[model samples]
Target chain A: MNFPPPITRLIQHFRGLPGVGPRTATRFVFALLNKSEDELRAFGHTLVDFKHSIRTCKECFNISLQDPCEICSNQKRERTLLCIVARPQDIQAIEETREYNGLYHVLGGVLNPIDGVTPEQLRIKELLTRLEGEQKFQEIILALNLDIEGEATALYLAKLLKSRVPKVTRLARGLPQGADLEYADEVTLINALKGRRDI
Target chain B: MNFPPPITRLIQHFRGLPGVGPRTATRFVFALLNKSEDELRAFGHTLVDFKHSIRTCKECFNISLQDPCEICSNQKRERTLLCIVARPQDIQAIEETREYNGLYHVLGGVLNPIDGVTPEQLRIKELLTRLEGEQKFQEIILALNLDIEGEATALYLAKLLKSRVPKVTRLARGLPQGADLEYADEVTLINALKGRRDI
Candidate 1:
């Protein structure tokens, strides 16, 4: 029942995650124990490297190696349209469509009252500051999930952007309620984007 | 969309696991990235330590910090009873029950001919060696899963052990069919153990 101190500690650490339980943590740690020293080293080094290398983009708050982020800095991308997403993974979902040529504003999280995640907890203030008059975005699309918190955040953003932007839109319905934007199929996401209605 | 070289390599490594997909790999890497530097170092060090610290017990084939394993070396354990399991995790499961005071023999893996895991590939030879009568066992319990591979391994071991030992038993049918032993609830597992039937 007694694992080596390090292995026990590793399982405890893995257990700290949102969905990982002690049993799953044991499975994960044992899998690591079965791996070769080189494999373990690679796994360990990757942990450090991921933390050291990936940083939140200064402009959009999306995870990136670069400061401005590739999406924010790309000249070929549409500058007059901005898609507001909740997380970095959400940005990847949008990009996979190959349809949304616009830049992104990653809020880092949705507004969840139970979690004490308010407007200030997200990158909302940073997002407002980044919206430039010279850049002149004609549309600000809220491509957040269809969940309650996602809806609340999108509604807040839509109302706030309505006064400043020419058009404020949210992705069309039928995206499988309470699910993640990441879980949406590419075609469904693309269709949702194409059929986005003004709020 | 673009991660650094080390982060990319780490995600690829995570993707190499049995059930992990590319998106899950990305999420896992990012989750690691969220860990503090000290935590990251701990995570990395744990992987290396778990692999380096654990060794396969020469007698039982169970992974442990010692050669004979804590269970094998313990004097108070029921030496006349040995539990045959498919993996080290199975040993951990039984140990957690705190009901079984018997020694254990890990087969390392079950016999799965389709996946090329033959009887010879398992620790059947070591198991046979342990039955040589100097420290004779009254009973050998086959605690392997009730799945096809597990059943095959148990039946093979049962045939071999029945010829050599006075009694050969199996964990009861209380366990749900096809589910992993590690996932069995503690009460159900305890019942299964207590209700063990002879083959």
Candidate 2:
């Protein structure tokens, strides 16, 4: 037999989430069902509030509470060093390292022709406009993923921004921190060897 | 840096779900953020409506749209056969099999003294009351899991239900369909050997 209509509806909504299949969605629904009416209502309100409050930063295309985002609006951040990323969440990952003190530009997603993710679909035009405007960055860092799509996007952006920016660099590819050299893939080993630095 | 306040709140809520870690929770929140405002609002409304409309079945203790539940109220189901399970979700699993036509009794949880899950906390009292009342069942099946706690509960319930009902039966333990005998655990293999039947 099928679940109740309300349960099924909630499950369907949860199934839309990334990596969440029917079973996981069902578990989430049941877990929510166990909560008190007040707690459930609060969760619902939180969801609505999240949607209502969240806005994409017009400058960087990053999702935030404000239009320009806290990073783009901050005066102390290094305007000369611009880091380009694939998505808003990637900015969080870079920020967590606390190593870089620079502005960011979110590309929305990497260029994947098969998936219909073209330059127009992403924020490439916006990035070009921002770079062409008053801001003059000394270096533009393409901090996208190490996948084929990310590489293609990075190459495309690097070529496009070479004339506008002084230097275009990508994040170094090497054996990740705490990763065993024995388990390192052939390409990672080759990259690590090719990009070796003197201590 | 951490996510925005609303995103963090929703992430916290998602993290409270079974098997969902902080990363998975963050992914879920971001996925929700990607949805349109109206769709997100509808999802929020669905959550509230789910909690409001859904109620525990007074007869079987299963979570359902109505008090008695569709199963408890159905006339075609076999009232003479009652199946006892630990959680409400177990009823859905058994119903999916379509092998049994009996009514159900949800015990909420098995008796786990270490975790403070005493008989008092379970629906043991309700089961006893039902058995003692006018609903006479020819066979009471204990369809709990095959783990230590389930075994303990099944044994306890079988003994208690023996005097009340004409017969008290537990689900047959054997090698599961398509399960490799070579990789079978010792306990399961022993059970399979002991419970061997004629073809």
Best by DockQ: 2
Q: In model 1, state the lDDT of residue B67.
A: 89
Q: Please give, for residues B1-199, the per-residue lDDT of candidate 2 as tens digits.
A: 5678989999988888999999899888888877888888889899988877778998989888888999999999999999999988899999999998989999999989999998999999999899888888999999999889999999898888888899988888878899999998999999899999999
For A1-199, candidate 2 gives per-residue lDDT tens digits of 6788999999999999999999999999988877888888888889887878788889998888888899989999999999999888899899999999999999889999999999999998898888888888899999999999999999999889898889999999988989888999999999999999998
Which 10 consecutive positions of candidate 1 chain A have the poorest summed lDDT? A46-55
**Which residue pairs collide in model 1, if any?**
none
Residue pairs clashing in model 2 are none
Worst 10 residues of 1 chain B by lDDT: B44-53
For candidate 2, the lDDT comes to 0.90
Per-candidate Cα RMSD to the true structure, in Å, reads 6.0, 1.6
| Weakest ten-residue segment in model 2 chain B by summed lDDT | B30-39
What's the TM-score of chain B for every model shown? 0.84, 0.96
Per-residue error (Å), model 1, residue B46: 1.2
DockQ of each: 0.53, 0.74
Please list the C-alpha lDDT of all candidates, in the order they appear.
0.81, 0.90
